[model samples]
Target: MGIEAELITAADLPRLEQFDGLLIRDHTRIDNYTFAFAQRAAELGIALVDDPVSMQGCSSKLRQAKLFEAHGVPTPKTLVLTRETLPIVPALLGLPCVIKEPESSFSRGVHCVASEAELVELVTALLAHTPALIAQEFLPTGFDWRIGLVDRQAIFACRYHMVPGHWQVVRDAGTPEYCEGRTEAVALGDVPAAVLASARLAGDAIGDGFYGVDVKDLDERCVVIEVNDNPNVDAGHEDGVAGPELYEAVIGTIARRAFGAGR
Candidate 1:
């Protein structure tokens, strides 16, 4: 895999013409430069790990809720949050529900509200800057199953354990007190069939590109958490069990898409 690659930043937009493909390794948001890069790559007919469509879809939890419902993908109870919907939240998702900003990344803008007071406080704070938010049923789980997929196939799997005494993966993310949980990559052969099936369905609902579908294994049943584009592939975490093959699978897909082998 002697693929010549170089690091780039937002300032290097003019130099994009020199590359056959692009792999975005940064947190993507609808209003960010990453999305612009994806759009530029698409305009240039370049192979990109996550096409602009995928980035846009994955950036909005509201859109994802509708997408999952339309595709019949299993997910926790989720609803769009607005000032009008505030009073009905408790009735819809109950207390201890989860609230998320549409463009949240790295678990920064996600919060678990255990009481009505907390729900209102958090939702009000979030909605002050954004037009809407997403409220989801609280599904308490010790860990979440992350299924990495490329071209609608599972390449690697890992269990992201929750931080102790916390309900989400990362506590105080984007702050000085930020801390995260443990990650244990698992062999694809050992992953539960239901988890894999749900992840594949979630990925299919999004697009046939790179994705990391997060799932919760509750009582042997699988519930999709979210579909993440431009998912992580850290050396000792996502690539732990799969080893070099993980890199090969991802790079090969990009190469094929770049050279018109499977575009």
Candidate 2:
């Protein structure tokens, strides 16, 4: 894969015409510059890792939750909470539920509320930024399964364990010191059949593109947590065990798309 890749900024939007294909690794939002670049790439007929369709699907939690239910992907009980509907969350989903802003990523704007008082306060504060929030039943799993998918195929798997005395994998408990749990890469064949099946379903529901499907395994049942578009594929963390193969697969896909090798 002899693709010449370059790091670009918003100032280089006009220069994208020189590239055959674009790999969007930046954070995406509906009104952000990432989406602007995606729109421009589509207009230029350049292949993109996450097309605009998948970006819209992955950015909003409310949209993803509905897609999960409609597509029969198992997920924790979820509800859309606004200022008016926030009071009924504790009753509908019960105490110890998780609240999330629609566009939050990397555990930011996500909160685990254990009481009614906390729920009210957190929802009020979160609503200042977003119009609605997603409230889900607290599925207390010590770890979460991250299935990396490339073009609807399982490329990598890992168990993201939670920090000690924390409820989520990435702990943001009022301090700058964040705790990152251990990442153990597991072979795709070694993963449970149910989890793989669920991950496949989640990947298909989003679109046939590069994705990281987060799932929770409870009592042998696999529940989809969320689908991520720009998933982590760091040098050592995500690619620890199968670093070479994983990198090759990803770059191969990019190369094929850019140069039309397989087509």
Candidate 3:
């Protein structure tokens, strides 16, 4: 990744030009400058991956839910609400819901509420962090599967073993000793049909690139929890499963798609 990661400007883009393609991974929700350059570069045929349209959609949880649900992909119940309409969640989706900042990522501003009172408190606290919020159904499960897809095809998938004390994985809960042993990097062959359908659903929804689709098989029912365009790809543990070829294959696919096949 250290291939001269330069922070270029909007004006600089047109001035200097020598690259295969450009990928905007500056967290567009926060980086306005990068977003502007990304827009301009795409118009100039710079080959921007995760096109601005797709990035914007995946950046918001509310949009992601709508995209997934609209495609017949099963996901946790979600309701995009303003401050005034937040109170109606209990009456609509009933008690026990998750309140999260739609534009937030990595479980930074996510909370689970088991009761109406909890929901109110959590919702209030969450709203203080961001204006847009999504009240979603709590996906109950011990361990969830994070299926990684490269260009609409399954590459590597593993069960994200959650800690007993903490239900969320994105949060930095100190050492991973709190979690289970190595994450089994099961081949695409072991992926169940419904799970495959869930992955395909996300791919069709997102329509591009290396994405991590979090799917939960709760009580024999396959439901997608979230589709992450930027899924975690760390493989630095001894016990954890790390398929080197799986890793290379994704990178190759990205390069092939960005630059031609026989480059």
Candidate 4:
């Protein structure tokens, strides 16, 4: 991480073949490096953290929506709109919807719109960031929950603050915040049933380690957003269950799944 990215990217490909386990982070950028490595790794019989097929599939909002529906997980009713085919927003999910980039990371291209005028303005801003976006029905009642999965298990979970008025990680928008978030020790029953099912589906879909599943629960049906490949384990840091114990579990899971050496 300290070295220059291009240097690593330009490094010898033949040397990389010496390793038995291939982690995507070996590539400086996941989209570029991970994708390229995945294509090559498949031939070498080495498994990638998040394979090319799942990463590519989850890269597009449309594909994610299909996965959600197939798994019976409820998500915001959304439309895949390009520059040419912008759908009517209200008829699909009503006002105060969100327009976001399908492949954006770190909330880079996500916007909350309240009205038709606001929607247009938000869309304009989003296009500047990402031309391809998903217009989703807004679920303002609750903050979007991020459930981190390790080896198809919900080991860590947290809820992100859409609005800081409620329990949230960070109050400032510009700065990254790690609030001592109140992450409930939930079983599958604590979360919306559909969310757990969807989380498992996402694990199956991505078939990787360190997955962060985004789900929307309206006290009833839980909607699946997308499965993230580089999911954060800061959840333990947020809740203060971190240090050694949590770290051990994380490493143990990775050893079992990634190396095929653990029980």
What ranking emerges by lDDT with the best candidate at the front?
1, 2, 3, 4
TM-score of each candidate structure, all chains considered together: 0.95, 0.92, 0.79, 0.73
Question: How do the residues 1-263 of candidate 3 rate in per-residue lDDT, one tens digit apiece?
Answer: 22334565555666534655665555555256655666765676665555666666667888887887778888777788678988789887776777777876766667777887777776777777777688777776776787877677777778776655666764452446433433556656777778878877877788776677888887678888777765667765311354676556565664675567773
- Candidate 2 displacement at residue 95 in angstroms: 1.2
Model 3: per-residue Cα lDDT at residue 124: 75
> Candidate 4: which stretches are off by over 4 Å?
1-13, 25-30, 83-87, 121-131, 161-163, 166-192, 238-263
Superior candidate under TM-score, 1 versus 4? 1
Number of the predicted model whose TM-score against the real structure is largest? 1
Give the range of the ten consecutive residues with the poorest summed lDDT in model 3.
173-182
The residue-by-residue lDDT of candidate 4 on 42-122, one tens digit each, is 777664555677566666666676666676555668787665545477677787777777765555446667788877766
Better of 2 and 3 by TM-score: 2
Give every collision pair in model 2. none
Per-residue error at 56 for model 2, in Å?
A: 1.3
Lowest summed lDDT across 10 adjacent residues in model 1 is found at: 254-263
Which pairs of residues have clashing backbones in candidate 1? none
lDDT of 2 at 235: 77
Which residue pairs of candidate 4 clash? 74-223
> How many clashing pairs per prediction, in order?
0, 0, 0, 1
TM-score of 4: 0.73
Pairwise TM-score winner, candidates 1 and 2: 1
Which parts of model 2 are misplaced by more than 4 Å? Answer: 173-175, 261-263
lDDT of 3 at 209: 64
Error of 1 at 260 (Å): 3.3
